[model samples]
Target: MISVEGVAIDTRHWIGGRRVASDRTFADISPIDESFLGDIAAGTAAEVDAAVAAAREAFPAWAALSAPERGAILRRVADGIDERREDLARVETRDNGSLLRSHRRGVMPRVAMNFRFFADYAEKLAHPDMEIRGHRERVTYDPAGVTAIITPWNAPLMLATWRIGPALAAGNTVVLKPPEWAPLTASLLADIAHEAGLPAGVFNVVQGIGAEAGAALSKHPGINRLSFTGSVPTAGVIAAAAAPTIVPLSFELGGKSPLLVFDDCDLDLAVDLAVEQFDNAGQVCLGAFRILVQESIAAEFQARVVEKARGLVQGDPRDEKTDVSALVSRAHLDRVSGFVDRALADGARAILGGAAPEKGLYYPPTILADAKPGSEILTEEVFGPVLTFQTFADEDEGVRMANDTRFGLAATLVTGSPEKAERVSARLNAGTVWVNCFFVRDLGAPFGGNGKSGIGREGGTYSFDFYCDVKNTVFSPNGWKESSHG
Candidate 1:
C-alpha cells in the first residue's frame, strides 16, 4: 500500500481476482509538481506467466457465458465506473498530469461509455449462415483465448477500457499492462471489475516498465492476441516479440496528423481548432502537429493561432483554469523542448512559446513557423504542445502537403462546402478524417491509422472482430457426393 496526498492506494497487481505482491516496486510521481503519488508493483516475466496461465485457466468458463450474460456484467462495470467517476478522474489527473476538469467532464464519461457501448454491441453481433444449391454454410465467432492489452500513458483508463470492453465482450480473458507512467487508474479499474462480479482471471493487470512487463506479455506463448497503443518503435518491438508464435497483433501507434485550414472556412473556428493542438498538452496521438493553411488567409490565421496559444494558461493540472499542464515526466518535457530547439536550428521560426517553464515539467503551447516540409518537427511526431505552420496556394497543394508525412493516423479539414469536404476527405490517406471540427469522436465508428500510424481498426464491430476469431462450417445435402475428382 502507498499513500497519495493522504489517500492510501493499493498498488498491487490484480491477478486471479486478487491483489498480488511483487518483489520490486516503482514510484508513481505526479508530473504536476513532481510529487510522489504512490508505489506501483514492478511486474516481471514471472508475473506475466502467472497472469497468462490464470487467463488460460479461466477461458473456457468465461467464454461459456452467453453474450447477453457477459454484456450484463460489462454494463455493471460501466455503472461502477460512473459511480466512481469523480474519484477515477482525480486519480487520473494526479497520475498523468491531465487537467482535472477535462478528466471529470470528458475522459471519465468516455471511459464509462466505452464499456456501455461494447456491452450493447455484444448482443447485436451476428454470424450469419448461408445456403447455396444443395450445400449449407454456417459462420461462428469464438473468443481469441488469452489476450494482452498494452496501453499508453496518456488517458490511461480510457484507452484501457477502449480495448478491455470489447475484449471482454467478445468473451476473451485479458491480461493488461498499463503504462508505468500512469498505472493508478488501471489498478482501480481492476478493483471495480471485481466488485462488478467479473470472474477470477477474467481480467488481470500487471504494472511495470515496458521492457519487463510489456515484453513479457507480448512474447508470452499463452497469449493468443496482443493489442497495443504506443510509439512506432515500441510497436516494432512488440511485433518482433510476438512474431515467433505468429500471434495476432493489433496496434494503434504514433501520428504526425495534419489539420488543413481552407480559405473558405470560418477563420475563428479554424483558429480554435488550431489552438486545440495543445489539448492534453498535445500528448495525444491524434493531435495536429502540422497546420496547413491557404495562402490567402495564412497570415491572419497564423496570427490568430499564435494569440490563442499564447493566452492558454499553463499551471497545475488540478486547477480548472489551467489549459495546459505538465508533460508526463521531466524526460518527456525535455524531449518536447528538444524538438523545438532542433527545429529552430533547422531554420524554423518559433512564433510563440519557444522555451520550457522555469520549474516543473511544463512546456508552454509552442508554435513554429517556416518549418521546411521534410524537417524533423514537421514530419516526425513531436507529441507535445507544439504545432508547425505551413501555407499552400491551392486546394491541391494543401492536400498534397497533408499527405506528405509517413504517418496517416488522422487528419482534419476545415471547409464550409460539403463538396470540397468530400473531395478533400477522400484524398487524405489517414484512417480518420474530421471536417470543420477536431477531436469529435463516435464510439461506433472505426478508429486507428494507416501506414506507420498503426495496423487494424478499433471501435464497435471492428474491436469485436479483432478480439474474436471466426470459423466457417460447410455441409453437403448428399453426404458422400463431394468426391467428384476421386
Candidate 2:
C-alpha cells in the first residue's frame, strides 16, 4: 500500500470503480524535504480511454436515478470525507507542502462542504416556467453524458471536488485527471466515493502528466462536457484539442488579482489582507497579489506590509504555528524566482525577500515595488508568495490600475465609505469584487473569471448549467382536454 504520513492510499488509476494499475509510474516527492513519497501510476491515452469508456457506459444508469437519489449518495460521500478529515488533512499536507493547520481547519472541511452544498442544490433545483404566445413553456435540465475534469496541484482535493461535487450531483459520471504534482488525495477520494456507495464507473480518476492523460481526456470524443482549472496556456491547449469535437468547456484559469488600499480605509485590515496573499505559499489563483495603494497612504502601508512579511513563520508545514511553507516544486520555485529576478533587473525594488532559500523549495516571501508599467511581472502570473506594490494618485487611477490587466479573476476594495465601495466595485472589471475582504466564497454566488482568467462560472446553478443540458418544452394551451381518450 502506498502511504504518506501514515495514510495508506492506493496510488493507481480508478476505472470502473476498481484499482487499475498502470505499466509506468512516476516519483511522488515532497517539497517540504525532497523526500520520496511513493510511485504513482502514470496514465496515458490507454488509461484515459478506459476511464472514459467506463464513464460513458455508466452514464445512463447514473442519470436515470432521481436527482434526490443521486444527492443522497453525494451526502454519504460528504460524510465519508468528514469521517476521514484529519487523515486526509495530514496526507495532503505531507503530499503538497500546505500548512497542516490550513488543511485540518479549512481546506478539508470545505471539500466536504462542497459535496454537501451541491447535494442539496441538486435536489432543490428548480427551473423558471414561462408563458410565451399563450403557450406554457417549462424548462428542464438533463445530465450531460460523461464529464472530463482536469484539476490543478495547489489545492488538489478542494479544487477537484468543487467541480466533482456538482458533476456527480447533476447525475453525470466523471473521469478526473488530477495534477501529477499532488495526485495522492485524488486517489484517496476515489476510495471514499466507492465506500459511499457510488456505483462502478460513476466516478473515476486517471493519474499522469498533462500531455498524456490530461490531453487524451480533453480530446476524447466520448466526453460531453469538460471542466478545467489551471493556467491560461494549458487552457488554450485543452480548448484547441476539444475544438474538433466541439465539447462544452468550463475553465477556471489563472489570475493576477488586485487588492486596492485606499487612504480612508482601515490600515490594519488592509495590511492583514495584503499579507493573506502569501497563504498556501502564494499558490492561490484568486490571491490578490497585485496590491494597488493610494499615494497618500502608500509609504505607511508598504512599510507595514514589509514588516509583516519579515515576521511570518516559514518552516515545516506540519507545524501549526508555521504561517508559510515550500512551493509545490523546485520548477515552480524557479519560475517564481525568475519572475522576481527579472523584475529586479528591470529596476523594480524588492522591499523584503528577493532570494531563494539556501536549501529546500522555499522561496522567501517577496515584495517587488516600482515595476514599470506593462512589465511581465505585473502582466503575468508568478503564482508564488510574491507581491507587486504600486500607488495610484486618485480613485480613477486606482480603478484604472486595478482593471489594467488581461486577468480579471477577482479584485478587493478597502474603504470606509460604503458609497465608494459600491461605486468603485461597479466600475471594476473583475468577475468578483470583495469589499474589505478576500477569499470569502459563498456557494450560492457565481465564481470564475472575466477575461483570460476563465471562460465560465462555477457554484450553485451556474455549475448545473455546464454539467447538464438545459432544454425547454412548449405546451399549447388548447392542445388536449381531460378524458378525451375515453
Best candidate according to lDDT: 2
Model 2 lDDT tens row, 1-486: 686888899988999979999999989999999899999999999999999999999999999999889989999999999999998999889888999999999999999999999999999898879998899999888999999999999999999999999999998999999989999999889999999999999999999999988999999999999999999999999999999999999999999999999999999999999999999999999999999999999999999999988999999999999999999998998899899989999999999899988889988899999899999999999999999999999999999999999999999999999999999999999989999998887997999999999999888999999999999999898859798995
Enumerate residue pairs that collide in model 2: none
Full-model lDDT, candidate 1: 0.91
Q: Find the 10 residues in a row with the least total lDDT in model 2.
A: 477-486
Cα miss at 257, model 2 (Å)?
Answer: 1.1
Model 2 local distance difference test score: 0.93
| Candidate 2 off by > 4 Å | none
Q: Evaluated with TM-score, which candidate comes out highest?
A: 2
What CA RMSD would you report for each candidate?
Answer: 3.0, 1.0
Instruction: Give per-model TM-scores.
Output: 0.97, 0.99
Off by over 4 Å in 1: 5-7, 480-486
